[model samples]
Target: MLVPRQVDPPETPAKTRVLFTLVFLGSGGIERSVCNVLAGLNPGRFATKMFFHHRPHPKSQQDRIPQHTEVVWGTDAFVYHRKMLPRFFWRLIQEARQADVIVAGQEGRAALLACLAGKLLGKPVVGMIHFDWGAFSREQPRRQLWGLRLLYPRMRRIVACGHDSAKAFQALVPVRPEQLEVIPNFVDGDKVRVAGEAPLPDWAVPIYQKPVVIAVGRLENQKAFDVLIRSHSLLRASGLDHHLLILGEGSLQAELEALVKSLGVESSVFMPGFTPNPHALMRRAAAFALSSRFEGLPMVLLEALALGCPVVSTDCPSGPAELLEHGRHGVMVPMEDPKALADALGRIMDDEAYRQDLSQRAHRRSEELSADRALRAWESLLSTV
Candidate 1:
């Protein structure tokens, strides 16, 4: 008779197991903000794992995830929930059962899945709100709103990246004041400083020689890059010679290119597709512009400020006004007004002293968005529940 050898018992994990669920890993500010939190968390105290319903997009900031953090790519799909809900829910239950806390990023299906899974397993769940609900609901479907009203109150806590987002969310859903917490988006200052101070990549060094006004984000309607291009055309006509460089790729690329050509400012406007590293461009840029119709504490604006570039952004709902502090740090132009945007651009370009002052303030203000502080706030929240 063969004797069975004695097996050693598995040791328990010392750190708190946390699971983060995302509908998809795409090139968005929310995805990058989550990555920043992963980078800053105390690894010894938090064993983090990320679950994605689909694979990360080619241009996504998925690469920013730390080496120690485990990532699981689930079944692939185009949209969140609805048809995919059963599959995602089942998978989430399997993944979330062992975790001490579940933090769900993105709204709609991801939030519903996390909340339901957490409820089933009795795990504490944090619902992360990355968009201004007032602005976001305008584009969402009826069922999404219904789902939010039904499921949001069940979450242990709701985290809003924008300072004003909590108040905006309360108008849409029936969440208690205690359930809402405001934590602004954060950027890696040291990473930005290093990447920005480095020399421009070979491909851009030639065309980027001119004073460039850079804007970074997916080339989508929400970003309103067409408005930025239109404003640039006006600036050119008014004798401003700075070239406009818009980074990131999206569906609006073809239309934006067409608009640039039609406006006859094609030579002055450059859309270089998705750039893996934008901090270098930010470092060399004369100014950064954000023309979004709305936002929830834009990550690019924070990165721009951290890199010491002055900024001009639309006073969109929830974010720009709070970030600029009513125009103390940067210029806040009226939303969707090309004339107003052009005027603000002209002011920054023509006045060297004002630009320098904005740049100094931008750097000083970036310290307030420290990744450590944001992560500590998150850790405290996670531990409490």
Candidate 2:
């Protein structure tokens, strides 16, 4: 049995059973957060059901949903309802009422379904806000349609990942300020290995004595690797010979590769693809870099800092500023500006003393966001619901 503590510290409750349901767990920031929550939740008090979406039969997401979590296949994320709404509801109606509360970290169509099912079964539904509520505000017509179809106002609460996200969500729902809670993404920093000099690869240690400029993210549009490639090109032209090694893979491979070739910096850029132990990589990296167009609080940046990796990231609207505490912990360059990005990267790479200072501050700041602390926050929220 999986159980999570139901009461806040200093107070004890007799008993409470809560079910945390994730309606979508596709590989992304939200998926990562849900995974963290599942892995971090106290198994003695709460049970988790992580639902996945892509052609759900013989589902693979179940394999990753953490052993403590009860992975449910053909669940809401699959939209099995589109094919058999009444029959699907017949099955889910029972599952919805099996706990004191149903936590849905859902977005898009799945959210509407979770809200409806939770309401019909008289279960408290806490809708988790992940990405921008919509392209603009929470009141996007899609939500209005969901409200009309599901009468979504019946759901109990809306949990947001940031202040801006909370505001966007309330713009659509008539939620009180107290009801929209802002909790940022976090990692178990204690588990993070402090970045000490690793035995550098035989070739890299001597040939390129400068700290390796490292960036990690999928090769996707939102990640903006092209911008990083362009910024790196500028950095190289300015005589900063440090090699750029990006870790992760995506469809943008051809375009990004051509950009590297066009910029004539193929020799300086390396893609080692997806790395399972990014924390280990961060430990030995000269610095961590992010050049994203937008983000919902990046997990990799948080992990990098915990590993003592000095960071230089584009000042994307909400995520970086919140994570770096307005550049107190790391360098934040203006978005989409290559010169600004290059200058920041150059400063961090060339100014050894400054980079060291930032690295220490980052590691110290990340220490507070340990898995235990994050779990306690989740515990507090679930207790109230």
Candidate 3:
């Protein structure tokens, strides 16, 4: 059964429509990201709707979204594999005949579907890209040829989440660098800050009275929480009094738990699974840590800074290095270096002067990504198109 949307019904006053189509919502970074975008968008300027391929349907994260937007459920999670591919295209044509814009991420089933739907409806579409599809796709050539070659040039604009992502988008299309828009993820700074300041809940493990380090991301291989765990074990072995808290879940949970035991750092490491309010935890923690193998302006990095948490992130390509301003604002250890990460963690935990300096710089850096500022950037892009 599909989830019910409490919509106010279709009310296109000037027969104009704005739709943002996506694959799904919930359980992962991408889904949470789409929610943040949807949250920042003003409803008056854009009548937004999210079309999902698959969610935890009937009881999905979509259910929790404010009633201002409509969430439409699509039948196929996979573009070519879904039985209703042709029919899905047909219905998209039928529904989007008058839509002014269709927002889609580049090189996913959603993007392909949006491209097809736009062509059928004679509607202009915009591709929103974070990372290149080839980085994660099995049928790279098909997506590149059919999705990129055929679909990209036809779209009105391409939006990238960060500078690195914009570069990735450039590779997909022959469009000039000036044609792409690089809008960093926006943060509702005041709200996130307020939430972060609140005291921790009673259920949270109380290991970090003084030396607390926190990293937030799913336990997926891509997030490389395993690498962080291994690094944390090294930190503990070096006589550091710090405890590491990792928030979020994935299939690697059991493997990570086992590794913590084998490494004998169970007393100093805690995995409390997923928490919707990660900022709350981030605020109380002494510093924020990210160990992702790569990212498209990782939202957790921004959220941590906005909450006034000093950050130490892996200097992975894409976001953190840029966000840290080449090591001025936050510490950036080379990716997958246990000793380097341990050293960085130790500095943040043991050295107050350096940590406070980084914390101040982080706050200043976060101001660049204010939600209001980003909303204006979006407004500018929307006007240009």
Candidate 4:
């Protein structure tokens, strides 16, 4: 009878629940990075939910989101309107209560709202800084800056997409040094290389038939497509004869097209709007170009490197120099300097040996920024926070 004692099995630990909030889930670098992180997370250790202030459009990167994530659209609670902040706030609070940790997918309203909810619930909030703070502050309204100054410090952790971004943020905001963490944007190189092998579309075939320099990003001021267009014109004047392919759609499409016409590079420069796969184009293109005025580690740059495409980028604040390893893996030129960009592009297109060398270096550097490394860093941060 004394030997009949029974013992129960040990209980399993609960998975950490994480809630990520964003203003929208559109086809942007921030959205792509978030999708990658969500997909890379270990399901056994963490459970994730995503909250969007508005419903994603059909063309948005909604399909890229992992299947395991529970997505809640605030549009379901109330139609999104600038005047409906109180309703959105309450809805966010309801969602935040169930999460052990809250993450603002990008800075601005998302950060403010997440910080407020985390404070009220005594939960930790992680705010992401996705742009150079100096450039971002200049573009945002005073109220936005005020809100960030007040709420950013309250965040349990602040993640910057690049080191320069972190430095700019610290100089602008009063957050402690310990609160800041730099996690560069990363790409799944294997997936990128596979996607790069996809055949070019019918329209893009002729463009890629000859030598071409490609740029991919939203056709907006921040991207400085105008600068890229000017650089292309300069290259053509120098008799480089390489076509310019600009991908992605934005409000400034009309303006950029007009610039192309004015520069007399209309026949050579192509604006094809947004494409689901730019990797395919990068794989075949002679060179990849980034003419950004500023960036928070451009994902397109990393994608180009992963495909072993030679890169020529403007030395923009917070990203290009760092991502390119200060001209080791790719060429870096001064921002808005069409001549510098043109010279760099011409060099890559003209010298096959130099281009091949850059290609090898790019591929090697990309391995350092692989998804597996970033995933481990993210898992560590999530588990601790």
On TM-score, the candidate that comes out on top is 4
Candidate 2 vs 4: which has more lDDT? 4
Candidate 4 ranges beyond 4 A from true positions: 1-4, 76-80
Q: Measured by TM-score, how close is model 3 to the native structure?
A: 0.85
How many residue pairs clash in each candidate at the backbone level?
0, 7, 0, 1
Return the top candidate by lDDT. 4
Model 1, 228-314: lDDT tens digits are 999999999998888999998899899999999999998888888878888998888888999998888999899998998989999
Write the number of the candidate with greater TM-score, choosing between 2 and 3.
Answer: 3
Q: Considering lDDT, which of the candidate structures 1 and 4 is the better prediction for this target?
A: 4
Misplaced by over 4 Å in model 2 are 1-17, 21-27, 54-65, 75-94, 132-154, 171-174, 194-210, 370-373
> Model 2, range 1-385, lDDT digits (tens) per residue?
8798787578554444555554444445676776777777776767666544333434324454679666553433454456655544455556666667777775655566677777677877777776554333332556554562344356676677766556656665666666567777776566546323344455444424555778887787778888888988998898877888887778888899999999999888888665445555567777788888666667788878888888888877457777788888899888778888888888888888998998898878787655676678777887787
Tens-digit lDDT string for candidate 4 (230-349): 989988998878799998989999999999989888899999887888889889999999998889988888889999999998888889899888999999999989999998999888
What's the distance in Å from true for residue 65, model 3? Answer: 3.9
Q: Which sections of candidate 1 miss by over 4 Å? A: 1-13, 57-61, 76-85
Output the worst ten-in-a-row residue range by lDDT, candidate 1.
73-82
Runs of candidate 3 with Cα error greater than 4 angstroms are 1-16, 55-66, 75-81, 84-91, 105-107, 132-150, 176-179
